[model samples]
Target: MLEMKLTITAPDLSAAINNLAQTMSARVPGLQNGTSTCAEATNTTSVGADAVPAANPIQVTGVPTSAVPVAPAPTSVPVEQTAPVPTAAPAYTLEMIATAGTALIDAGKMKLLTDLIARYGISSITELDPSQYGAFATELRTLGAQI
Candidate 1:
């Protein structure tokens, strides 16, 4: 025979009793039914027909208790996606050289042009169309001058 004292505190008395029943059932094997309630046979043994049992019966008492309120489940939010940035193309162009030359001439860059023609080739410039120049226009011009 085993004697035990159990005190259960829960938000409600019924919940506490339910918890206590489960706990008692687990601790005392074969003493409780599937529902955690003591079997009629065990209850009868505690209070037999002839006389009261010798050992003090297991007592389960419940007291009203409080617990911190649980917060609600968090809401899921969708994120906005941004498009990828485009890569910039190379800066060198035939038009850039022609434009630079024209600007230099306007700003008294004749000496610069003469040096360029000497260093590169002037004949290359003759092959290029005045309306359209590419990245190698200056080199072509220098080459043309040399030829």
Candidate 2:
């Protein structure tokens, strides 16, 4: 009669167990489908009468009975891209318009300013809508006002 005992280290246990399962599956018919009556194991291992040698029954200690498959890493990672935000032009202020109007008046171009304002159906600068300030500013610029 002969006896043998093999001890596996903690780090090597996983690899050892995998190799053992492959060997057992090949040797034992019932272990091929990962099931047996001798002992229960998760995903890979199974034990039965034919799984163990008559002279030496293998024993595994301090190891998890389950085998978890690791997922493969992605071939290429996706990168998120963002478009640049459009910057809005500054809104024209009433004070800006007043400065331009005062400049035109001081330059003796009050008629030109008044005529420009009148073209927009407005008799006075105060009567002008805030939204029309941009167009008014552009006109005042053409009339030589430092708006």
Candidate 3:
């Protein structure tokens, strides 16, 4: 029986080990470069029996486990559009008619009276009708007195 023990000192033991592994791989049959078969065998024993040996072990530094990033949920908001309101037309009132009548009488336009009579069928103040004028006779009488 023969027994031998060899010891080597290097500035970078990892680099020396890697170089030795590369050299041993090139020299030996069925050995990958820059990796220890013993280390791979130890890892295989540590894992489940169902696990298979990796074809490329030199590229692996360690087991990789990372947390997957999750994106925030998208926010949604509803938008509303408003339209402008339309203005109403000015109303024709009895007070407005009286004011206009006073102005007409002050202007001394009796032709306005004849035109009104022809249009509304009211000849005089006392005989003034209201049906055609739509409740404007009282305001017209007040305007006639002013004249």
Per-prediction TM-score to the true structure, in the order listed: 0.26, 0.40, 0.24
Q: Write the per-residue lDDT of candidate 1 for residues 18-129, one digit (tens) a residue.
A: 6776666566645534453221222223333445453323344332122223788999897888887768533445556656666656767577666664554454444444
The candidate with the higher lDDT, 1 or 2, is 2
Query: Where does model 1 exceed 4 Å of error?
Result: 1-93, 127-147
**lDDT computed for candidate 2:** 0.68
TM-score, ranked from best to worst: 2, 1, 3
Distance from true position, residue 82, model 1, in Å? 14
lDDT assessment of candidate 3: 0.48
Off by over 4 Å in 2: 1-86
lDDT of 3 at 112: 68
Task: Please give, for residues 29-147, the per-residue lDDT of candidate 2 as tens digits.
Answer: 44444522222222222244334433323454323343424788869877888897859755889899999899999999988988998899988888889988988898999999987
Backbone clash pairs for candidate 3 read none
- Backbone clashes (count) for model 1: 19
In candidate 3, residue 125 scores what lDDT? 39
Error of 2 at 29 (Å): 96
Position 53, candidate 3: lDDT: 55
Best by lDDT: 2
In angstroms, the error of model 2 at 129 is 0.8
How much is the lDDT of residue 23 in candidate 2?
Answer: 65
